[model samples]
Target: MTVLLFGITKDIVGSSTLSLPVSSTSRLRTVGELKDYLSSTYPRLRNLSSLAVAVNNSYAEDSDKIDNFDEIALIPPVSGG
Candidate 1:
């Protein structure tokens, strides 16, 4: 699956996009799983106050389903003056 990064998420991951390989034995099925995977892979992500995930352009809940063909994005909390 490919995940787009935005705001601080982009800086944390060090890239604007992230790709995850999918195979029969290992596939991410839920949004929560994706969050766990990312947090584990990029420990710094766990430090963020909040992280929102969008799948196919809509905000997704932890129970939301995900697939390799879906569009995903990580949106970090944004603050402005």
Candidate 2:
């Protein structure tokens, strides 16, 4: 699957967009599950529980279904005044 990521998520995952070699039918259907997979792949993301997800430029929750063709975005933390 491919994901268009942003913010500190890039720092955690080490890329702005990512492509993996998992099975096409693999089911990582939720933001939480995606987090788990990401945490496993990028151990540095273990402490990123507060990060938010976006699919197709919209905010997504932990239970959101992420499909193979979907453009998932891993929007990480931001700081501003």
Candidate 3:
């Protein structure tokens, strides 16, 4: 699956596109899993839960199932304007 990045997530990912070894058929089922994936890929993102997430341009939950080709992004909270 591909996760669109924003804010500091791009820096952590080192690029805009992340072709992870995720199941394209079964999207990310939980935030914990995604966090794990991120941690495995980018060690700096291990504590991803400190941030927020958005699936397909909307706020996502811990149990949300990311669908195929879904646009997922790590909507980290901004500290200031």
Tens digits of per-residue lDDT, candidate 3, 7-81, equal 778888888766666453355577657866677768887655576778788887877777556777877657766
- How high is the lDDT of residue 79 in model 2? 73
RMSD of 2: 1.9
Tens digit of per-residue lDDT, candidate 1, span 1-80: 89999998899899999988886315778999999989989999999999999999999999999988999999999899
Query: By descending lDDT, how would the candidates be arranged?
Result: 1, 2, 3
Q: Estimate each model's TM-score.
A: 0.92, 0.83, 0.75
* Candidates sorted by TM-score, best first: 1, 2, 3
**Comparing 2 and 3 by TM-score, which wins?**
2
lDDT of 2 by residue, 1-81 (tens): 887778777867677889865673276877789878887878877776577888888898888887887778777677799
At residue 45, candidate 2 shows an lDDT of 70
The per-residue C-alpha lDDT of model 3 at residue 78 equals 77
Off by over 4 Å in 2: none
Can you tell me which runs of candidate 3 are displaced by over 4 Å? 21-27, 47-49
